[model samples]
Target: MELSRRGFMKAAGAGVAATSLGAMGFGGAEAAVIAHVRPMKLASTTETRNTCTYCSVACGIIMYSKGDVRKGERAELVHVEGDADHPTNLGTLCPKGAALKDFVRAETRLRQPMHRRPGSDRFEPISWDAALDRIARLMKDDRDANFLASNADGVPVNRWATTGMLAASATTNETAWATFKVAKTLGIVGFDNQARV
Candidate 1:
């Protein structure tokens, strides 16, 4: 056999190219490598069952948390996923439910009541008690000013036209019923539920 320089060069180039391509993952070897790399963060966490609060569907969720409260360290939420045993979700989650973990852990989430005074450009954090007091005072004033005792036909009627209550869809039926009763007692005629909207 005659060894030509051109043939030798071609063979060497092909060998180098094959080696480089294999190293750069031209084949499916990268997938195998990634498949073996499992996350260890959830290994020692505790799992709890919860319900999604975004809407009325009330999808079940499995919440994973770290540490144990009995051991002195507070448990922190680490992950959230649809609960397989839940009757509503059945191990599947909508886009919002799937991102519930991010929402719960988001840095921008409001932790306290905020109030922006008229003509103020920014919202100022307010205590929950102060916020509730202000809300009750304003609602009472509105109700007193707008309460109608009688119509033009001289019929006895009690209704407040200025105040409206929009109930959350995530509330349970009992809660909704209680809210409705409260609205009726307060003479609030303008009421709606978020689920209907």
Candidate 2:
């Protein structure tokens, strides 16, 4: 096949016209997308790298959001998918991880800490600081009230059996170390991890 200058110019012109139209959202390029799907919502949203909180695997996830929440704006979660560049799951999500979007958007999902007073029928949302302070106070009270200083054999066995600590196993080594140190410092005898369950 012999190509002339006129034919080459015509072909190039057609290609340029099609690409320019597609760039302007004309949807004229129906054959296939170039490199990626340019019109998808996933391309327009802000991508966030996160870890799946469902289990001990700690699969890497990509969360796409629409607005800026740091400036006191309303941010909507648009999509959640496994990150291909991650090392844990390698872009594959389990049954629960696959439906993480639904989990996040579920009506019953707890967005804040809720507390129900003694004999109260329902729970009410509270500030994060208040919740943390309440928990710390309760734990301190429990430890002070029921801490065992010594055993029957006159051995110094400092233990707090009434309160327990459950740590997430998916945390990093440093976090796990810190958690263990904190629990041991608190004299917590009933320390467990989520992976064991």
The model with the greatest TM-score is 2
The sequence of per-residue lDDT tens digits that candidate 1 reaches over residues 78-167 is: 889899998888999999999988998889999899999999999999999999999999999998888998999989789898899998
lDDT (0 to 1) per candidate: 0.89, 0.89
- Stretches of candidate 2 above 4 Å error? 1-40
State each candidate's clash count.
Answer: 0, 0
Q: What is the Cα root-mean-square deviation between model 2 and the actual structure?
A: 7.3
Give candidate 2's error at residue 167 in angstroms: 1.4
TM-score of 2: 0.76
Q: Clashing residue pairs in candidate 1, if any?
A: none
lDDT of 2 by residue, 1-197 (tens): 98899999999999999888878767745445554656775776788988898899989999999888887878788888899998888999999988988888899999899999899999999999999999999999999999999999999999999999999987777999999999998899999999888
Worst 10 residues of 1 by lDDT: 167-176
